[model samples]
Target: MSQAALDSLIRMAPVARKSAAEMVVEKLLELIYSGSVKAGDTLPTEQELSAALQVSRPVIREALRGLQILGVVETRQGGRCSVTDLKPSRLAAPLQFLVGLDHDNVEALYEARLTVEGELLALGAARADEAALEHLEHMVHEGHRLTTDPLAFRVMDLEFHHTLMRLAGNPFLERTAQSLYHIGAEVRRVASETPGVLTNSAREHELILEALKLRDPERARRAMHTHLASILRTTREAMQQSP
Candidate 1:
């Protein structure tokens, strides 16, 4: 046999053990990461993959379901599964699962947001174009105007931060920030429900936007830190008060 064929055989060498479903999941992930499968590419039919991988149809279905839950693939009735754009919303289920089982995950999620938003704000200050700046300004004004309605204000608050990340001109950063936003949505809602949190959050947004408008990276960074710190404080207070 040729060297390439020998190598292929080596790669396919038997594992000591793995469940059928687990093997299917691993192979599918390998295909995805190796670029053998690209986003939006429809996967082979269940029957076909089962035959090719020597796994049962039920095992294949189970593996696909697992991937679907992770936002790695989308399945349609009577159609093949397709790779999906990995996104933050995809994290909702897993994040919620962990939050339910491990309370401390909530605090860790907020800390992640603080770190990411701070970097994004500094980048937005240094790189935002005129249009991006206008977008951020609009969100700021909208947030401020909605301060009396805590729920509405919270929505605008999230939008403003997301807009800042968009202004950062980095697709990876924007995606990561959006994912963090989705994961933290519930936490934010709870925080916003607390008395005075909305007002304080809106005020913080104003200062951050001012810094962005001035193109002052230091001020923007500092404002992001303060805003996120307040959010963390409010979140901790809310968690403590929960019955």
Candidate 2:
């Protein structure tokens, strides 16, 4: 980037509430979103950033490290950093940790799923072609066979949701939905251990598929809500039964 552009991007005023590193991270993100820093572009050197942001080197370092952990940036050999491609899968990596951090988070995660996947499934219903619908049908049939194997059923169950997300043709939402589906894998494994949990989930898959087959977006969304509600109930039961 030109010096003029860098100057514009890096000019920052001191903020009170948050830590300096946190403020730096927010400023850097603003630069990225504002199109001042394109993906794959190497960031300003540590010394340069420290000077430009009027922050200490350690603060800039901490901010960059945090961004690295979030998959927003990558460190090359010799300590140079550049923006990553920022794929949804990479950006959504931290969500796994966030989802299982506390007892209350599980419910909040499902609530998010209901909002995100509901719309994704509705889109899938409206947009899926014959091939997509056929593939989903095959998955539903396979799900029935996997009821005897909880682990395998869970895998298939996740894929069923993934396939639906793909049908929606939104990479961002697909990655988000997939990440959310994976949040409570251990609990879900236990939930699947319930005698009829997998069976019921398979049946719910059938209901979702039926709505998709009819190309009814509203019906598909409703089916997904019902399916997720059932899963959430079993998940809570499994959590209570855990110990």
Candidate 3:
């Protein structure tokens, strides 16, 4: 860290709080997100951070540990710390853990999925080119063909949504939807056992792809909404029927 950067961080030193380590973590994140420290850049030593932030070295160490677990930073063999690439998978590690912690909150997870995936769908419809539309069409066709094969169909289902997220060109929302989707994986396995569930999902995927083909954002959003609602319903039914 530069002297100027150290001075800036000192100015925003965290006040006493119940979780001082968390506060320190936030401050350090500010430095990362604010572009003061880029990926692969070495973070200041614990002594430097402690002195600059006016916090104890132990607190700084604790904060660094938190960052490491969250995949934000890595400590190399000699105790030097550097920022990670901030890839979606890496950044989403903590969220994936949090989502798994509350298995009963199925509705909450779907609601969040609707918000994130809906936007991604709309953006994909607006921005996808001919090649993207053609690729999605192929995925939809595969969904129909694989309806009888739950395992293969489930993999295609996930890839279909992942394709849309990539089309939206937003890494953050993509990761969020990915995390939310994983939360329902077990429930989806149960739902897939229900005879009509995969068939309906295949049809809904077709509807969504149709809207995307027309390049209609609002229509695409409505299609996505219907598809998600159907999934939620089947998930609830599967949960009720679970042993």
Candidate 4:
């Protein structure tokens, strides 16, 4: 971009005087939201940003770090910072920090799945293509075959949920649900370790598949609800038993 344009974009509003560093961050975010800067675009160098915003390099770097923490931009090797793809799931990067990643908060991950994924399943039941259904069927089969192996079973379980979300064709829902799935990994692993959990999960997958095959939205929703609820119960029991 031209220096003049960059300068105008980063110029602080002429109201109450906030710190230049904070204004730099606010204006930078404005550019992103305004689509003046887009995903996959490399931001101007720190020197350029510093010059444009009339802020010190230290202040510019600090602003950039805040954006990075939000998953808004990524710093590559050699100091190149680029805007990220802006996936909705990435927005939840602060959850672990804000909630504290322990047993209690980890449970939020499971609740998030149940809350978001039920809708995805209902939507997927109507929108899923033959290819998506076939892939989901394959995952169910894999889950059955891997029941004796907790790690393999868990992998299949996670992939199955991700695929289900993707099948919904709602980018925001898929992204948020995928993030929750990842965030709840520890709880999911614990649930998988519970006796008969994998077996029950595999069977539940079949029930979901059956509902999906019928193209019944309500049935699919019920099936997903049952499946997630089973795992939630198992995790709760495990937590109760823990020291």
Measured against the true structure, the TM-scores of the candidates, in listed sequence, are 0.78, 0.88, 0.81, 0.79
The digit string of per-residue lDDT tens for model 3 on 140-226 reads 999999989999998998899888888887788887778777775877898897898889998999999999889899999999999
RMSD of each: 4.5, 2.4, 3.2, 3.7
Who is ahead in TM-score, 1 or 2? 2
Candidates in order have lDDT scores of: 0.73, 0.86, 0.84, 0.79
Model 4 C-alpha lDDT per residue in residues 1-243, reported as the tens digit of each score: 345547667565532246766677788788778777778878889887776666678888888888888888898788889889898756555544434335666467667777899989999999999999999999988988988899988878778888899888987888777656665466567767777888988999999999999999999989988987887788777667667
Which stretches of model 4 miss by more than 4 angstroms?
13-24, 38-42, 51-59, 65-71, 74-78, 84-108, 241-243
TM-score for candidate 1, please give it: 0.78
Residue pairs of candidate 3 with colliding backbone atoms: none
Positional deviation of 133 in candidate 4, in angstroms? Answer: 1.5
RMSD of 2: 2.4
- Residue 16 of model 3 has an lDDT of 68
Candidate with top TM-score is 2
Sort the predicted structures by lDDT, highest score first: 2, 3, 4, 1
Between the candidate structures 1 and 4, which one is better when assessed by TM-score? 4
| Best-fitting candidate, scored by lDDT | 2
Query: Can you tell me which runs of candidate 1 are displaced by over 4 Å?
Result: 1-22, 38-42, 52-54, 69-71, 76-78, 84-102
Tens digits of lDDT, candidate 1, 71-121: 888975667788887665563445443334125776687678778888888
Task: Estimate, for each residue in 1-243, the C-alpha lDDT of model 2 and write its tens digit.
Answer: 457657975556753345989988988888888888888888989898887878788898999998988889999998999999988767866567655724777789889999999999999888998998888999999999999998888778877887898998988888788878878888888788889988999999999999999999999999999999998898888888877
Q: How well does model 4 score by local distance difference test? A: 0.79
The CA lDDT at 46 in model 1 is 80
Misplaced by over 4 Å in model 3 are 3-17, 33-40, 47-62, 69-71, 85-94, 101-104, 241-243
